[model samples]
Target chain A: MHAIQQQYWAVRDYLSPVLKESKFKEHGRITPEEFVAAGDFLTYKFPVWTWEKGDPSKARDYLPADKQYLVTRGVPCLRRATSLAYTDADEDAERLLSFGDGSAAGGEAEDWVETHAGRQSNADSAANPGSIDDIPDLDGDGAHEDEGLSSAVGNLSLSGAKVPDTPHLDDIPDMEEDLEDDDDAAAAPSKAAPSSNTVIDGSEIEVANGNLLQVRTYDVMITYDKYYQTPRTWLLGYDENRTPLIPAQIFQDVSADHAFKTVTIETFPHSGTLQAASVHPCKHASVMKKLIERMNAGVVEEQKAQRKSGSKDAKKKWMFRRASGNGKDDKPLPDDEDVEGMRVDFYLVVFLKFIASIVPTIEVDSTTAF
Target chain B: MPVVQFTQFSSLVQPTFWHELTRLKLEVLKLSDASVPLTAHYSAGRTIKDRNTGQEVALGCNFTVGSESFDEKHSLPPFAVVAKGIVKNYNTIDEFKNADKRALFSQAADEIWDSIEKDHDASALNRFLLITFADLKKYKYYYWFAFPALVAHPLWDIEDDWKEAKEQFTDKQLLSLHGHLEASTTPYFLVRPAVAGDGVDIAPVEDYTSFFANVPTDSQTIGFFDPSPHPSSPGWPLRNLLAYLRAVHPTTTSTLRVLCWRDTEPAHESGQWKSRFGVLTGGPAEGKPSAVGWEKNPQGKLGARAADLAPMMDPTRLADQAV
Candidate 1:
């Protein structure tokens, strides 16, 4: 049913006249020029991300020289997504899942978040359960109310269990053992195997407390996807020992909801023969549009509340003035508030927020405020 | 006192390196198996722990090379030791497997030794050889990297427990030494306290004879751009430098103070000092030191590593796999 609606939307979008004014507002899509502009804004504001020249042979003319794509290296992935699911931080999980349904804009989103964190992992909402919540967004709230996603959350855990059944993780135990043997064999090429490294490797990783201190790092790259007209994110993960992670090991770090479905191994467009797991951008624009709409709705609500209370705080007034400011020469600030303010420069920032939901374990968004 | 064991250098070949190798093979190196000079760099290491035993594991230090390595005049980042490398690309996988790896390693080792003995080029100590078989049709590359370091006869023993370099020098002095080391193009250098007594005077390794001429035997200090982050051990490059030192200072029986210069940022502000000072005693064999340095594969075997880039390189496979 959701697939049919997706098809319908795709057809409707194709049949409709192309939007001339800020296509990102109507649809999540942007031009390659906007991609470069957004990339510049991202790098300028955050500084964690830098534009890379990449391979000169693969450089696209639309993007500026030395700005073919954006990259932020050595972003720490402290733990795996599986360990994050049944974890502690409730508020962070709530905020992370607020946009889980992709189109949960306005008042309905609040209810979704209130019950979202405790009951389900990201895989639950990211899977078919999203269709249930999405139904209300499309066919109005009251037509077939059905308890409004509280029941959907209960049913999702069963689907969420299916996440562990991915073929990539099935042989993880044996694979890990093989790697352990490799370490031993590599250090002592003889029968004695009495190298100090053997002793060092054994003690520092797992102590009595059982807290694994292996620090897995990732290099995240964002490239403009011309086909999807959205920024595509690629993750190249490293093991605690700084070896490049195989595809199966990399899958363990990605969110189960999108692991094999939305993310796949593809050669980095800007690089030669270097393949990484990249999140598919086909659905990115649609999800981004909803997130923007949600932000605009929240802004409109806050403005209504402020006007009702008649609170003329100077800071609040400054924000209001900027929101509606029609100055002839006043260009919007680089790190200003997002979306409805029509700050298209904040596109990648919002896109990163979307990516954070996918790879929550990787701290790539730490450099950006929001 | 303990026998010193130098940390070996593991090869970290980037996919772009293979891609560049393929391009070089098709365009430039066709029908010729002549060795080509390439560049690799030694960066810092991360200590990985054993999952089952929970003990600390010391991984071999990595020597990373990439597409830019092929550029004749490529410059590495600060504090990274320039790992001079030679690539020997064979035409077939059978030839790669059947080739005499020991003889090949010795050939490279001999050139490095000649540079040390004849030319007194201090940088020759940090050399690596890469043998590869690029199966272009299948997009699979089979390669092995060996960083040859000559083994001293009666192996050098640590004369004392390792101490942080900061303990031996003031912040101002360390900063001055760091400035000198960063400015020097050669990876190896000589250092001693200034005669007038403000800071240390650092000289390139070529001036080792004159630089240590006036200095007393006990105070003679030599430093190298250390790549390994191992608490107790220095990197593989230091092995050859010691061999060179043994040859040059043949008659001396005095203890030598070795400095593992591992600071990338300046010593004053960064606050993260990885440099170490160790006292060593012993020398290489009389005429030539025996050498042994071949990197082990990921599976703990002395074999070439393989990377299949079909999913990345093949257009049809990539399209099929694309979401």
Candidate 2:
């Protein structure tokens, strides 16, 4: 066995006796199965809960051996169960049910263990119950809401039990669908359902009861817009010779004076036991190059139109006054003339640089998920 | 001694005629001495009698140098010795003798030499001789008749001496002379020559004669008749000199002293009888100088009191007081 697994069992073994003694003292009688169950729950919850004395539900004094056993074995088991529920998809459903059971146990065993041990351990039993309650509620929601809540709680619960579940090979397609739906919802809100939103690849095995079961597997599905899929051809050179591959439209308004044109390169995907060579080929570079050329032509055309309009507006301003002359002469004096100077708006340059830097990221498909 | 009696006449004589008569008296004094008392008699001719009354009126007068009494031995020498010296040098006898041959010379000599002697003396004579010769050389053709014939000649030199002596006489004589000719002439005297300084020539005699000729003969002489009795009436030339001195020596009291004048009659009471004359005393003994008072005649008419002469004397000072 691996060291992590051996360490897990050692804690479990040490806690079995304390859980048995605590259950017996608190309920006046307790079976080994109930003791094991309580011990596992406490191990999942570890360090967040401890046994105490004089709990209203318990009848006997808590003993030192029982207290030490609970701390050494039951707390670690409860912590392991919580961490496994977060990171291992196979354990998620079991942990959800166990969390409900743990919340129902209150501090009866903890009180019994502390009284028999003749020690005071006032670990927050109230705080542990709150986390226990949070686990079961997460499962009843839709996949999108559940994933969001899970990720959010995953970060909040830095303790072992609250880690997020890793994607399984069989479950990857569903997760991909959920992520795609979330991205779409975040983006256009009113767009049609995404088409390339699922992944399918996993093996099923028959168990001893002849029930069909799936082995643990992992798959990562990535989705991106046309920009990120074909980024190489979108690599544009700036005045400073810095090349950016992002779609300029992603970062800047196409109608603005400093707007840029863009293209998409290639999309990337990662999966368990899958080599990059097996991935399907796409005309990403050619598409990106064509899109970039088209966008560049459009930008040139817009610039010409802007120049023509600007020159015409300037002519109008020079020939006429904006305000009423109120019967005074509207024309400038014969000797009075304006000399035009060359000017370039630096704000436009800075804005273009910012767009270039960010657009390259949007154009390149460096990650598997959208 | 013979006593000569004569009747007085009613008609007033012209002041020039009186002046000429006095000049004749001085001439007689020059021809005589202290031991001989000089006397003169005048018979009013028909013209004079007709202007007055048809009666024949005769007048006699006598003049002596000093008294024969020892008690008054220190008195001034009689006019005779003084006048003899004057006449010896200034006499027009040669011209009078050859009157027809040199009529212009004789007439010129009489008007120039005689007038100078009657108004100047020895020191003034020397100054006059030197200055007149310079002025003649400077203004030869312009002052043709007067400068050479009267001022530059030897006779004119002596006559200038007597004229100087007359100016040194007491203020009584000076004032009397001023009044004596005030009506028929504007009385003028020769001031000390150096009073005008080295380079300046005496004022032209023609200017004085012309000024005298234009004096209003009908106007009354309204000032003191005795020079010693009061102040000398400053003639136009002396007044002009005093004005120049006042301008140049404004801070000096001695220069200003010559400008003082006194009126015999106070301004409020005198009316037309007022008399105005220059006071020979330096200034008022105490307090501020008071302006001389007299009757003013704008039209040059006798007895016309149209304005007061006090205002004319120093209008600026009166104005200051009024303010």
Candidate 3:
């Protein structure tokens, strides 16, 4: 323990003089190593939050207010915080859409946007409570698109030619109101479709205005993108819940264009678009398959033994992150019965590695905060 | 120093094996965009050819309401034509109260939909609506899709398809029939990794949206993309969508129509294809997260019991005054 503290001080003391002077600055800033030392001492180690409030120290991360953080192993893990901390569940709900409310919220009020600026509501139409039929019956009105061209969503009451014969007419109960326009024909699918079923967790993953944050249960959802053949993540937020923040809070200042740029899975033919709920990574399942095959066959244990004896193959094994000495989560998770747990670890590990590269001005104490 | 493995062989379970993910969560909004009713006129789209492969692809109808086509005749060709004929006009009408503002900002979303309806008849993209929304206030474009094209799911029987591809109707057009009356359904927000490889061209935002706001002062911003397994896909569709989004609209608050179906009712699979139901459930790529083997999740089996937790959690850590 003393050695660890000494090592920490050694690094900090070496860098602090230069960092505080600002004379060693390159490009008007200190290096990551410098920032790591200076930040820890000035912000974290300083316990300024306690002093500012004139209270006993309450760990540096949980700020005075509206600034929360995740507590892992009883310590705040900002690395994971960079990727995912708090989630404005409402934002996630806003992104998800059910077929039934497609028009009321989708066509009318535009709430589904990856916001960069503040909450920019739709300028044109407010979210309508009324269903399609409730909108003034456009029995004869030409409407937005040409009535002749509006084969699907146009004038339900007027466009008799295309309206009566729609195969799924029975499925649409609302169309019955406008059917008065095409009273002549109404044969449809035999069965009334099952009742609606899309239930979105309106727990805001992030706020619409993105000003603050909340404690997150599930911050981001990742999925395999077969189209791009990579893992796509939905960056719901990076909230630790130390404080209540505006629903729309970003982790750092990364733009939605960069942070929320995600993979869209068009369940073609299914008419279902399932985007990964968060910015979790997608690895080729083959990697895990290979590892699982080895684990199932007990090859990994043998490799571990060989690695202890200094076999060269152990050095080349990329299956376990070859670069990190602390093992995953600093616990040396060399083997486990739960292969699935290992798979999640694999992604978390890789995702943490990727985030470290993007976070830019921080000295990484360990590859993963865990 | 040693490598940290991603697969616990256990931390997370194969979600496929878990009971079907029936309930999806979402945020619901009723779209009442007054501008949607604007008349969109279309002109003929151009046929673009790949520079290296010498292959030609057709761009859907370009919405040029009361204007001439500004098709690029001469250009530094990219690997392939990502998207064609999508334009957002940013001739910011300096409050020309006399000008037909609505007509000036008409959308090509429907035109793209019409073309995709024809182009992606039997394909996956067919089930998606690559949409462009124009917010007259911001003068920026935001793109979205009424997607999750689940039309031709392998599971759905041909005759019993919710909406058939054989009969060409856009996803939204088909949605217009079903989405309205149904209550409780919400679209879930999910994302995919942008898969990039050969034949995938994620063009710069300028390549497509530049022509929309042809003014010298006009600028555009591009969004990020996901890696996909398929090649030469969505590049064109997304480009076209963004083209209109960046040029014409005040903002691209594009919303997608994602169906969030909960558990599959037993009746859905009881008919002819009852046997086919468990292929994925019983097969690989499915299961729930569990600490112990088969302790939870009816779908999982006790292939191997979990190893000791001593190794999974850190065995060495001295805290406070020392244990």
**Candidate with the greatest TM-score versus the true structure:** 1
Candidate 3 residues A1-370, lDDT tens each? 4237535644653454322332221112222333233332322311211111111232122222211121111111222222222257435533332334333211443344432122222211111111112123235655554444445333422212221211121221111111012211111111112122111111222234452222222222222232222333332222232111111122232222222222121111111221111332233334434444444344345345434544333222333432233323322334544322222223323433344443221122233212
Quality of model 3 by C-alpha lDDT: 0.23
Question: What is candidate 1's CA lDDT for residue A206?
Answer: 37
TM-scores, one per candidate:
0.66, 0.13, 0.21
Model 1: residues >4 Å from true position, as ranges?
Answer: A1-51, A62-64, A70-79, A87-204, A207-219, A222-232, A238-246, A280-357, A360-370, B46-60, B180-186, B193-201, B213-220, B251-254, B266-271, B314-320
- The clash count of every prediction, one per candidate, is 15, 52, 150
What docking grade applies to model 3? incorrect
- For residues A206-312, could you state the per-residue lDDT of candidate 1 as single tens digits? 33344544446687999876656688999886664445555545655667677646877766777756778888788998999998777556555555544554554
Residue A317 CA displacement from its true place in model 3, Å? 11
lDDT score, candidate 1? 0.65
- The per-model DockQ list reads 0.19, 0.00, 0.02
Task: Tell me how far the alpha carbon of residue A199 in candidate 3 is from the true structure, in angstroms, after superposition.
Answer: 6.6
lDDT of 3 by residue, B246-323 (tens): 222324313211111111111222221100100010011111111110111111221111111111111131111110
Cα-based lDDT for every prediction: 0.65, 0.21, 0.23
- What does DockQ come to for candidate 1? 0.19
How do the candidates rank by lDDT, highest first? Answer: 1, 3, 2
Q: Candidate 3, TM-score vs. the true structure?
A: 0.21
